[model samples]
Target: MPRIGVTGHVRLAEGTAELVYAELVATLTAHGDGALHGVTCLADGADQLFARAVAALGGTYEVILPATDYRTVVGDRKTFDDLLGKAVHVDYAPFATSEPAAYFAASELLLRRVDHLVAVWDGQPSDVVSSTANVVRTARDHGLPVTVIWPAGARRA
Candidate 1:
């Protein structure tokens, strides 16, 4: 069983969700269907999409919250709750508050726990601390295999 983790932008342009989902399904399927596990933060855009794909393909979903009060920070409470409810395991970072540190901590935990990483990035550098590019670099530094997914017309908000 391979554990796949995801990191990507929270905002995506119109009509890109389907592309992201389809790419994820293809990527996960390539890994073979025997007990796949997906780890994600369940964030609005790419993270939530990846979780849905994992569930659709009979994989277990694991959620890692950046802080204890992650529900408040997540953009869509309904979607967050929906994914959280379906998660096989849920863990929170040691941080007490939701901040950049907490997000980085959660990212580190996600990268550390998974065997591979799936990054839904637009190939742009980010000024934010816990950007998808940063996570991909970290994963590569750790020797974890990475799959970057950016559809032809995909754009970030």
Candidate 2:
């Protein structure tokens, strides 16, 4: 029963979401299934895709919102609301507002709590603190196993 956490680019190109979802399903399946729990921020792109895949597999989804006002900060209100509805548990960081700080705080908590990390990244350098690359690096630094999934021809938006 591995607790898998997710961090990824928010802007994905067309068709990438399906690819990511398939890959996540395969990976989650391989990890055995006593109790699969996925932790995510439920953002518009990869996070939401991972949540859906986890739920489809009969696993529990746990949401870690970046801030108190995450509903307003997140891109797609409908999707965020939908995913949040399915979450078994929802927690928020201490940050009262949203931005890079709140995002980083949420990422740190996700990395700290999960047994493994799934980074849906383009394998590119991240220019910001909360970028996928930075999150992957942080996970590795903490000696957490990371599964980096970037399907062939996948591009970020």
Candidate 3:
């Protein structure tokens, strides 16, 4: 069982989610060989897509909240709550609000718990401290294997 983790953009273009999810399933199945496990922050786009794919594959996943008020800032309330309920375990960062520092803290914690990282980025750098690219960089710095998934038709909104 591979403990894979995910980090990526939140605003995906229309119909991009399906493409990313398919790629995720393929990657996860190839890596886990059936028994799959994932770690995610459960944000709107990439994180939610990864969780759904994991469930579709009959895998388990854990959720990491960037802050106590993360849910308040997330885009899709219903989807976020549903995914949160399905998580095998949930962890929270020390911060009380959803900010860059809290997100960075959560990402660091998420990195420590997984053996591999999957980044669904568009290969762009961001000014935000805890951007997907930064997380990918951090994972690489720690010598963790990362698989970047950007399908042909995938685009960020």
* Predicted structure with the largest lDDT when compared to the true one: 3
* Cα lDDT, model 3, residue 77: 97
Candidate 2 has what TM-score? Answer: 0.96
> Considering TM-score, where higher is better, how would the candidates rank from best to worst?
3, 2, 1
The sequence of per-residue lDDT tens digits that candidate 3 reaches over residues 1-157 is 8999999999999999989999988988888778999999998899999999999999999999999999999988999999999999999989999998999899999999999999999999877888999999999999999999999999999
Model 3 residue 154 lDDT?
91
What candidate 3 gets wrong by more than 4 Å, as runs, is: none
TM-score of each: 0.95, 0.96, 0.97
Off by over 4 Å in 1: none
Worst 10 residues of 1 by lDDT: 26-35
lDDT of 2 by residue, 1-157 (tens): 8899999988999998888889989988887664799999887789999999899898997999999988987788987898899999999989888888789889999988899999898899877987888899999999999999998878888
RMSD of each predicted structure = 1.1, 1.1, 0.8
lDDT of every predicted structure (CA atoms): 0.89, 0.89, 0.94
Flag the better candidate by TM-score, 2 or 3: 3
